[model samples]
Target: MEKKIVISDEQLQFLSKYLNKKFPNLSPQVKIELMDHLICGFEVKGGDDFYQYLSNEENFIKGFINNEVKNVKKTYGKQTWRQFFSFFTSRELLPITILTLFIIFLISKSISNKNAWLIFVVSTHLIMIVSAIFGMINKKPLRKLDEVKYLGAEIWLPFLMVTLADNLGFKNWLIQNEFIFTGYWFFTFIYGVSAYIVLRRQKKIILTKYKALLN
Candidate 1:
């Protein structure tokens, strides 16, 4: 019986850093999986000459990433977009979207005065900023669901962009303007709903695809 070779921690760190440079876009989850395969599979294959063999054949790493990693990237890309579009089209999201619309309509009716709506907008945004900062400060260990960070960004980017445009005077887009105000609230509420979807969907994905790895 032969003893299996195990990769050293220093070597693992070096591999992690080198591969990170090669595939900087890979999620932390993907990077960890690569390291797992290299340590468990590649290192074992070369046995006594493993280090020397790996040093001479860096292309092996590149080939693995270009093939395996790219495929993973594509699958992730499609899943990401589908989750986003789900906000607009999925039957599950339909009720949430309707609820958000009702909230916006109520906001509009509650503050018929333009100046009142301005105050509401400013106050609401201030609360949102504080909430985001607090959430970031207390965030827990990253799960695959936490990979929903990108999807979360997509949810919020619309509001950020609209606000940026208004502030930059791209239009006389005052929050006091009923159209602009409602549009902002619409995005915000949709974002809230999409966030719920992200949490649920990412949990499913991790359990379905990475259950063994997670366990």
Candidate 2:
């Protein structure tokens, strides 16, 4: 039998750091797997020399990272949707809706009736800005993979609100009628909750990956 391919402690540390830099865009969970893949490839394919094996055309780590990326996309996609939808029934969503309704109701009662449209528009900006701020604080390093879901999703509410606001007559209509206001309230409520969920999820992603990168 061939001698065992045991990696030294120093070699393992070096490999871990290399993998972290090589796949900075990958989430830590996947990055950990990539590190293992690289090491295993080096051990199995080496002809007595680790450096030679890594430099050879047959290095398997690249293949491993590609396959792992597919799995990561599928796994993260499902979890992302679940986390997003969970906000619908969450307690935080209720208080926000009630508060929005109360505030908008007050604005409708006291605003220069001509500018009631500003209520939803202003609220939309506030939610999106808050989400962006949270994202800024919980920033993740740039990765090779696509990762704009959190902040990207957060902007849709503001975009929609701006478009709705363009039709000044309809916005006034939404503000003036209790029935129409209910629809507007529901829309803003859903968006606010969704934006909150996305921002929180982004924070979790940054935290999870940051720990992995350190190791």
Candidate 3:
């Protein structure tokens, strides 16, 4: 026969406060799921009365409290990552785009100086290529469903970097009046289009994962 476990008002209040503080926007469904887990935990502790269990096995109670704290910490960490993903998929690209523009500006200013512009453009391209190669080769597997969005970002970011670098290189070459590179405009157009597509795809994937977790 399975043991029945009851939680005290104090314990429930503590959990509620902790959950609310840690997850202010936690959905009611998720709250119920967490409560169910807590009930199972209480049952597994194995005692006729909750207070008796706590008093009789001080070490167990201590361990349980420690575990709960660790769980809360982990939850916060996950939450932080989810928030970061939101920013990364949307606003974080802005800095990279700006950096690419700055590089273009510098290259354009140094256009008359072929040697300097060539060195800068080549160095930037090489770095971007190496980064893309490494990112593709050393990509980690997604451990959680929520991490799928991150994985998708990883998959697309290299392509974005490459496109940005290619565009910048073409711009630099054009400024140098070398061979009249029109590919830069094409690459720039592609970069913007791809960025929008990737952002939307990532947003949908993340939101789906978030909804699944709620259930």
TM-score of each: 0.48, 0.53, 0.29
* Candidate 3 C-alpha error for residue 155, in Å: 10
How close to the true structure is residue 96 of candidate 2, measured as C-alpha lDDT? 65
lDDT of 1 by residue, 98-173 (tens): 7866777677657655654554456446534643543222223333233434433433544564467567974344
Q: Candidate 1: global Cα-lDDT?
A: 0.57
Model 3: per-residue Cα lDDT at residue 195: 37
**Could you tell me which residue pairs clash in candidate 1?**
none
Best by TM-score: 2
lDDT of 2 by residue, 102-192 (tens): 7767776676655766655667777777766765443334333434322344446555766764656476566668556655655665556
Q: Name the lDDT value of residue 26 in candidate 3.
A: 46
Worst 10 residues of 2 by lDDT: 142-151
lDDT of 3 at 190: 31
Candidate 1 lands at a TM-score of 0.48
- For model 3, the superposed segments whose C-alpha errors exceed 4 Å read 1-3, 22-32, 47-215
- Top candidate on lDDT is 2
Cα deviation at 211, candidate 1, in Å, is: 9.2
Model 2 residue runs over 4 Å out of place are: 20-30, 44-46, 55-116, 138-185, 201-215
lDDT of 3 by residue, 1-215 (tens): 77566677787786667656654544444556665666567777756565454345446434544555455445434543454344337676557655655565555455564554455445434434543443222213222322332322422433454456457665444545532332342233234334344444444544555564445
Relative to the true structure, candidate 3 reaches a TM of 0.29
Q: How close is candidate 2 to the true structure, as a TM-score?
A: 0.53
